[model samples]
Target: MELSEMQALARRVRSKYAAMETARYGREWTDEEIMLGFLGDVGDLAKLVQGKAGVRPRDDLDEALAHELADCLWCVFTLADSYGVDLEAAFTSTMAELDGILAAEDTTT
Candidate 1:
């Protein structure tokens, strides 16, 4: 799916989770709380990456890594939408800047 589609799906899932959180914890997660949850997902992804590197053995390593990566993406999409960021545009701009820097470095070398 395209990035926009992925982002839309992520937002929908985030809304569902927010509803569940509200029912379970008296209110939905604040932005900071959501970010903290994302951080936890990142930690999980880091371990999964180790497994992928064969440093940390895991059952179903590939599947676990894919899920963790998706979880991280979901958090990023949700956070970006919540904060009014045009993530696609920002990503494009950032990549261009990095590529430009790399090209300049290559010329110097």
Candidate 2:
């Protein structure tokens, strides 16, 4: 699926979670709080990445790494949607800029 499709799916999932949070805790999580949750997921993803790279030992490391990556993606998609970011365009532009920077550095060197 495309990034846009994934974004829509993430929004629906986020809405469901927000409703559940409101029902259970009487309030939905703020955007900042959601970002913090994303940070935690990032931390977990880092550990799983390390394990998958054989820098650390872990059982079911591959599966765990995949799950963590998806978790990180979900958080990013949700956060981007909340902030009105066009993530697909942003990603494309950012990568192109980075590529140009690297190309320039290579030419200079």
Candidate 3:
């Protein structure tokens, strides 16, 4: 699926989580809480990457890596939605800037 489709699914999932959290904790997670959760997922992804590198030694490493990556991506989409950021546009602009910088450096060298 495309980025927009993925983002739509993320928002739908977030809505479900919001309802669940409100029922359990009387409120859904705040933006900071979302960031913290993303951080935890990032940490998990790092360990899984190490396992992929054969330094951490995990069975079923491929599946774990895919899951963790998806978890991290979900957090990104959720955070972008919460913050009112156009993630696709931002990503494109950032990549374009990087490419320009690299091309400039190549000419200078």
Query: Which candidate tops lDDT?
Result: 3
Of 2 and 3, which scores higher on TM-score? 3
Per-residue lDDT of model 2, residues 16-57, tens digit only = 999999999999999999999989999998888787678887
Query: Mind giving the per-residue lDDT tens digits that candidate 3 earns over 1-109?
Result: 9999999999999999999999999999999999999999999999998998888978889999999999999999999999899999999999999999899889656
Q: Tell me how far candidate 2 lies from the true structure as C-alpha RMSD in angstroms.
A: 1.7
The CA lDDT of each predicted structure is 0.92, 0.90, 0.95
Instruction: State the TM-score for model 3.
Output: 0.95
lDDT of candidate 3 vs native?
0.95
Where is model 1 more than 4 Å wrong at Cα?
none
User: In model 1, which residue pairs have backbone atoms overlapping below 3 Å?
Assistant: none
Which candidate has the top score in TM-score? 3
Work out the TM-score per prediction. Answer: 0.94, 0.91, 0.95
- Model 2 has an lDDT value of 0.90
**Which window of 10 residues has the lowest lDDT sum in candidate 1?**
100-109
TM-score of 2: 0.91
Worst 10 residues of 3 by lDDT: 100-109
